[model samples]
Structure formats: structure tokens, C-alpha cells
Target: MENKYQFETERLGFRQWKEEDKIPFAKMNANTKVMKYFPNILSREQSDEFDS
Candidate 1:
């Protein structure tokens, strides 16, 4: 069956966001280098809110 949550290739896969993704997403958002172009890194609450 086709998976609505996923898109894949030979070496890579992307999927719909899940609750599990929040932690990692928050961590990535917390990175200063990554947020450098933005005004500031987002808080977990803010990230989760924006993510939805």
C-alpha cells in the first residue's frame, strides 16, 4: 500500500511530521548557526505551535 506519511527514494526518505519530530525539530531550531538569519531561536512551545 502507498504510505501517506512517507516519500522515499533509494537513499533518502521524508515523512509527515509526528510528535516524535518535535524534539529534534526543537533542537535544530535551538541552533544559533541555523537561526542566525532569523531574529532568534524559537522556544519549544513556540516551535510546536508554529509547527502545527
Candidate 2:
């Protein structure tokens, strides 16, 4: 797939979210270490909705 990035740097790029992001995004959202600053961990459904 071609990535049409809105912004880019030498090592990073920003682009629109894809369907493939859901699972991993949910995993990250459920990680206590990752969500330490946030209120709480997200359920898979909540994560999917947040991605939408």
C-alpha cells in the first residue's frame, strides 16, 4: 500500500488511520504503562470506537 503522509520527517511520518490499526491500538490502550497519564485502560470495543 502507498502511504500518503500529511507530514514527514527523516524517521517519522503522519498519515490517516487504517483498519489494521485497531488491534494494536487497542493493545496499547490497554497497557497500564501506556495509559498511565489517562484515566484507565480501554476495553477493545472502546478502543475501536476511539479509533473511529
Most accurate candidate by TM-score: 2
TM-score (all chains, Cα) for each model = 0.70, 0.77
Looking at model 1, residue 4 earns an lDDT score of: 65
- For residues 1-52, write the lDDT of model 1, one tens digit per residue: 8876467898888877889989998998889999999999988988888657
Model 2 local distance difference test score: 0.92
lDDT of 1 at 1: 85
Q: List all candidate RMSDs to the true structure.
A: 2.4, 2.3
Q: Model 2 over residues 1-52: C-alpha lDDT tens digits?
A: 9669989999999988899999999999999999999999999999999756
Residue ranges of candidate 1 with Cα displaced over 4 Å: 5-14
Q: Assess each prediction's global lDDT (C-alpha) against the native.
A: 0.86, 0.92
Error of 1 at 5 (Å): 4.5
Off by over 4 Å in 2: 1-3
